[model samples]
Target: MSLAVNPRFIPPAASTFVFDPDLVAEGRRESVPRYGDPIWSVLALTQNPSAPDDCIRWHWFSGTFRETFRFAAWTLVNHPLADQELARHGIAMRAKLSAGRIMRTVHQWSIFAAWLDERGITRLADLDTEGLADFAFYLAKTRGLSRNTASGHLTGLSRLHYYGRSFLPPSDRLVEPPWVAEGMDDYLPAASPLGGENSTEPITPATMGPLLVWALRFVEDYAEDILAAHDERRRLLNAADAADGPLLPDSGDALEAFLEGLEAEGLPVPVAARRGNPLAGAGIYLAAVTGTPRSKVRQVMRKPHWRTYTAQNHGPCHLGTPVNATLDAEPWHEPFTFDGIDKMVRHLATACFIVLSYLTGMRSGEILGLASGCCPDPEGPPAEAGRHLIYGRVFKIATDEYGNHDSAGVVREAPWVAVPQVVTSVRVLERLGGDGLLFAAEVHDKRQPERRSGRSLQLSTLNERIERFIEWVNTHAENRERESEMIPQDTHGRIGAGRFRRTLAWHIARRPGGLVALAVQYGHMRTLVSEGYGSRSRGGIHDLLDFETARSVAEHLSEVHEAIQDGEGISGPAARRLIHSAAQEHHRFGGIITSVRQARSLLADPNLNVFENKDTFLFCNYDRAKALCHPGRSGKYEAPSLDRCKLNCANIARTDTHARQLREAADSLVRQASSGLAPEPLADRMQERAQGLSELADQHDRKRVLAGMEGHL
Candidate 1:
């Protein structure tokens, strides 16, 4: 028999059967449920301080992979192996793998298990080597998996078999390198062609120039309007609580009259509304805008206070709050989503997220993990000059022996050297999350997949909103009659994440005036990282990697541009003409690639193709470098390098992404100087940088102008 504990709201409505407890080990009661409960949710909420762990029916069910799915769903495979310690393995793996990874792996294995049971292979001891070989063949042919993908499955199986190898009989155990027989490679699916690297595109003027401009302005000017409205709403709700009695619930007449007497006699109110400014939730907004993992977003939301609230089928329902939520946004039967003050609060959060993410290259997860008091410590050691720091838990990198988070879902120990824009965002979120967590309440609840209740916002949602934020910028620009500020998408449609980071890095590495906004933000994370986030932290390392990748791309493009000036042969009619015209003018540009951004401007022309020479790792589309081409080459083979490029090489081209970054840098410097915040020396430097950038922009513009005048001129 089980005892049920119901959670009652402060207003004394019907109780919710939230935590169901089971008596185990001594008289001390634990909320451990039997076979049917979501054990993970119970385990998770069990950690909650305020939760009634001893005697309550936990509302959510979030057990391990096996508990939540195959086993819980009542698909009992009555086999000896199924009853063994593999369930423990699932939880152990969850420590290393993300929740998303855990789900996918569990699903895959569950399918394999069901297939095994159907084949009368209930126990591992009963299966032989022939069965293993047959299963591998079946997995490839039946699942239609590519060679690499099938290999991954086989790897997973190998690990599991290795785990149970000690307990199983020697004959029953699957051997290492499953097929020792030589020349049996033909039985498995062939591996797919190894695809080359996928470079993340940088945001460019030709790509999302206008969109970025509008987004920046929105962050600067319009975001406050929403925040102001939300604050005012909170103030009004507090005032209402002060004016009115706790509730008009149908209590006895004597109780009602006694309560009415307080209002009639002008006495103080009984209960107050929830406290804390909603602007503190800006971290949630940042996570949504920037692209944080769904897990971190929920952590931020849950802190400080639970965001999800539910109305228990009571109240007269005529509270004059915002029209966004006049009643319970969700019925008692439905899982909760934010309503009332939350609607206004979340609106501001959304705005903050969209604006902050575009301005700062902080990862979505990093932004979400941010706490209230985590940046630019004024009283830090003076030796830490030249670097701005952000203190927060980084979840992905520093795994323990069990591959689990260090504490309460936090994998902390380092400070990220942040930009001022990121610092400002942190400050804003500090106000929202206070000295506690950054995100809380109304987070997506994963325990009950059936309902959208207490959960963290999934990664998919954050990315989707990122796409939505882009569309919003375009729509808002059109609405404001600022068509020139319109941000456009690539042919693939939608702005990409990888290129955005690369673009920022390119500007920083190039040190161009147009991209100077991020200049003050750059620092060697290693300088401060040693004290906190040891070398193991992946967040700091990843940021550095982005910077390096952009630098490499810039150097390659510059080398190719220099080659063209050295009278390298050109491909295509337009490219040949461009070379001939450029030969007349003694112009040489590169080194600080952002100063010129030649690739961006030249890319506007229609008759150019940027193709990568996989052999040389250089972009060459002259199509004349037949020897460098992978196939269809008629000429003799000759080695090519950036130092010694022949005029016959056809594989020379560039991307406009870097050029646009340079343009932005110059614009930023101009803006900074105009604000009069920069020092005199810096101001002078800004003007000089701006002038050089304008000359480069003009050079590119001249080509465009002359192109427009083609034939007619």
Candidate 2:
């Protein structure tokens, strides 16, 4: 007997019961939903969408998935699963898979559907355990699929059959899979794990260090030109008479006319790339400046308007309130100008994307998803060290109680501890626009300005913008050194969204922990413990990078340990302790560490592995509530003052690579002191720091140090 439910028992379309109380009536949306509740209705929820080809082209689904695959006479029309993908049928499933994954399942289901129809298998009774086994064998042997792939296809077909059984006519009801593949892994072996580096490898120091220096220095270096030019353009616009000619922002069409005028006068104007928006290249400037994403840049520049901060003495100030022409006193309608002034706004947003993504080990999506006023208590100082935070949205898969991606994905309200640069970027964004999206999309339908909705820069658009932004940087650099160092280009275009988090993690992992600034020691173990106590959410690239950073540290330690075993010498006051640590805890069973447990135990000794003091360049192996460099030596295994590292600490160990750096430092300091450019006191301090490093290097045998240093770093 067929074991399928009756078609009449199935529930009707979910849209009939969807209750969205917050949806606004057309044309009069003066206000939108709050951050966490941003659900507007879509036409597809009510009716069948356009052809798969056309549907995938829309901004929402424009990923790499090719939906229009040809399979003879059949069309792969797999309907959307309600509680998955979107806030779809409201049945949010727990395991939120990737788009590529979802597409693969649907494709497999469609292929199975085609096979069944071709074989004239019209009813559930037509298929049995024997036929299912035959198909599985056919998939494995005839089609040359691995056994695991064949098993997965069988599982997918079973799921499709179960879902369709209730909806199909009684004659077509498909029973559950007759055979189960679970626990048969020994018979049908799983795919082997990948060896070597993952394809999306972390950015190396040689590739990323120069870019970091450029991004950190560029915006401020060009600040005078960027802002002065912005002010001049604003003045020109504000001074123009309405009756005499067109003004900026009043008509979207006026932008073209203004640029044409510049060109006619033999002046420079923003140039567009071939088949690309010339105006979008400026986003790179903003990405570098703020390290946010293209979306944020677009929102702020769409309409550059903002409230002004006035002098305290200027009675009854309303800095952030919307402009009330008569009551807004003056400077109220000032162009949040730099945005269009030589494409400054977009540049600033791009700068924000680049810096935050690179420095904080954050995903580009998380940084770009940030909204206005995302920073917490900016006017007030942080209550404790490492408490400064930035509020932003995370774009990874998240679940509601039902396990589906929540409507807002994840509204990251708890402040992500931020550095000062991020804080500054937040403040800059706040001043760019009023209470709408901070980084608004470029003016899309210039004729219908009033009807346009505020939008973020789409992923496809952002990728293009990133490329253009890189080109823009190359064009503006003073020389080839600066230009080539920006984002080494190729046919694949500029560095991508994935590089930032991994690169940051790689650099942080490589920090020489023992001692650069000798006075400070950090409670790095405490920090690691604290991180462990917090959420171990690895959905975002940023979260994954955190684990990757820890892994990198462990890997680096193993490399050093192996080198020492091969007859490398250690240096400094702690050399004996370091060698002893390396000698005793040799890792058990090597050759591509398949077990994580073994890897952890391999680097567990405090004497062998060092923790980094993020605040200062100190790696303390201090323990016993007695940090040698921490004042009074009074912190436990997890509580050292990273800011108090002193080069004289007994707990510190020096590597050969670090000795070379010390030599360079000592020579540089001597040269500076000899020259008239360095003052006496500053020169003395530099000499003292350099001398400390020299003493540590001098302790180790020069021949041994020189031989092993290359391997240490």
Taken over the whole model, the C-alpha lDDT of each candidate is: 0.41, 0.45
Per-model TM against the reference: 0.49, 0.59
Please give the distance, in angstroms, between residue 128's alpha carbon in candidate 1 and its true position after superposition. Answer: 3.8
In model 1, what lDDT does residue 285 have?
27
| Per-candidate clashes, comma-separated | 60, 50
Tens-digit lDDT track for model 1 on 121-222? 655446666677777788789878777566655655544454334333343344443543332365469755332112344555365455444444444443
Q: What is the C-alpha RMSD of each candidate to the true structure, in Å?
A: 16.7, 13.0
Estimate the lDDT of model 1: 0.41
Give the candidate number with the greatest TM-score: 2
* Model 2 TM-score relative to the real fold: 0.59
Worst 10 residues of 2 by lDDT: 45-54
Per-residue accuracy of model 2 over 1-713 as CA lDDT, tens digit each: 11222236432232321222234335423322211221322221111111011111112211221111111101112233333322422221333333333445555655555566667765444677667666666676567776657666765655445444434444444455555333334324345342212334565555455545445443334333444555454444343322233223433333334434544665543322324443444433333233334444444445423101111111211112232222124321333333344455456556656666664555565665566777666445456435456666555554567554443456653446555565655555555544544444432112323323444444444455555666666664534344545555443335676666655544444442432112111134224323532354444333333344345445545555686766655665555555554444335332233333444444454554454443332245555344555455443333344456766676665556555666777788778877878889988888887787576556554534322353452
